[model samples]
Target: MMNNATVFTEFSLSGLKDITTKNRVILFSLTLLCYSVILLVNVALIMTIILDEKLHKPMYIFLCNLCINSLYGTAAFYPKFLFDILSDTHVISYIGCLLQVFIIYSYASCDFSVLTVMAYDRYVAICRPLEYHSVMTRHRVAFLVGFSRLVPLLCQAIVVTMTSKLTLCGSQIEKLYCDNWSILKLSCNSTTANNIVGFIVIFFYLGHNLFTMCSYVQLVKCALQSREGRKKFLQTCVPHLLCLLNATVALLFDLMYARYGSASVTQSVKNFMAVQFLMIPPILNPVVYGLKLTQVRYSLLNLCRCNKQVKGLN
Candidate 1:
């Protein structure tokens, strides 16, 4: 980690503005539509889980938490991004940038934790079918939700502690937000300690999720041994597999391209990764689970029809 004197009070980001105006317009419109869909669907999901006690199980609880996290994750970065595109300015103050980074990390981390918890829920539901209810009780559900929320806060606290110690005396970040590596790169002093922290954070980020995925894999294998169980097991695992695959690819590209590529290349890579990371999970999640699992779709449709009837009566 290089520690530099804080020379810049604000930093400018040269995001996709260098592209053609026509392309920018197209992207802006698409982004607006996508954001609208994300907002509508996630809000509906949260409300459905909250209003219906029948859906108030550990699984749906985690699903609701995931939706909430995705909402925050999108809100943290997308508004500023849209503004930058429209105004032709990517400059952000130090404080706002820091807030953006913290929010992004917080939500992203929470989402990861919730996914792990969801995997565990699935495991118990499949592998230990008899004890699913006992193992994933209300208290356990509350604990999982609480744990997911707090872990991200703790991780961010550690990050803030480390970043606060750095002396940004001479340089400024080039990105739209105050990212870890971008800030570290701007440090005028040695960045060794910061690098170490980053590595540790990555380990924490990947370790829990990977372990959970492995457990699920084993559970899947066990479930597949029976001919009748094979189809149901595949249905249960495929959505999760798609989500994991999308997230992993996005994260890998975000890490590698941001570090090694040229500015233009980095932005391009991040632009695509941003869509995958920000949009695909939320969009595909409900679709995956809803379409793959008939019960959820039926519940959602029932809720929709109920709402419509109530509106008509009113």
Candidate 2:
């Protein structure tokens, strides 16, 4: 085993080794298409929310941030992933690997945080209708949005810093992208401090999930008591729930794969498990909110019509 003093400069990603040259081209095309669509849809939704004065409410503002985050998260992975698919070797430089870890994990944390805030927005709208506007004021919403982005970036920064300080015995990362736990697994020294900090971050985010659940539970209780409440819940809260469920399931798959994944698993299955979170949630969130929210849908339609009219006038 390499000792603490051993210097490693790069990591070879073994995840894409199974692809044949012919298959690599095909996969690269498909991946590029997927990434393009993720960008197109997310950008469209974000622009729709930003340009429409009618969508400047607290709920839409939260959604705009969520969409912005989807773009942020995907930018970290998709470009590099597409390049890896086309290249003969799948290796990432040390700094590149650490940057990926920081962006990906921070993106995950931010997803949960944004969803938690969305749940709170829904709860206020439905449970405390009279104070929804007051409670989720423009200033308060700005603070919460800023908080959602800042906290995750800060937490993941510490994780990346801690992981970077470790002396690694090996440089093979089993997955297509760099992950914090995977790097931690290569450490030549004690990782107790890292593990403790990791667990604390996990439990903190888990608490965010629990808070979301409690909010929904109360939302369900309140929704059932009134017809209008039920309508509001179905209109707004359902999409939030779907986004939450998608993010939760995607993260769970990633967690399980990182922890107990076996070589015996088929490469395709392993790849799917490894990237499910990165691939699904970023694409799914915007689609879900775009289709489910009436205001957003209408706004999008109006934007389309206005664009066509401009084309005709020109």
For all the candidates, what are their Cα RMSDs to the real structure? 2.6, 1.1
Q: Number of clashing pairs, model 2? A: 0
TM-score of each: 0.90, 0.97
Model 1, 37-144: lDDT tens digits are 888888878887788788878877888888888898889777877777677656887777777767877776777788888888878877787898889988899999
Model 2, range 60-178, lDDT digits (tens) per residue? 98998988888888888999998898888999999999999998889899999999999999999999999987899888998999999999999999988999999898899988899
Worst 10 residues of 2 by lDDT: 1-10
For model 1 the local lDDT of residue 19 reads 61
What's the lDDT of the predicted structure labeled candidate 1? Answer: 0.74
Best by lDDT: 2
lDDT per prediction?
A: 0.74, 0.91
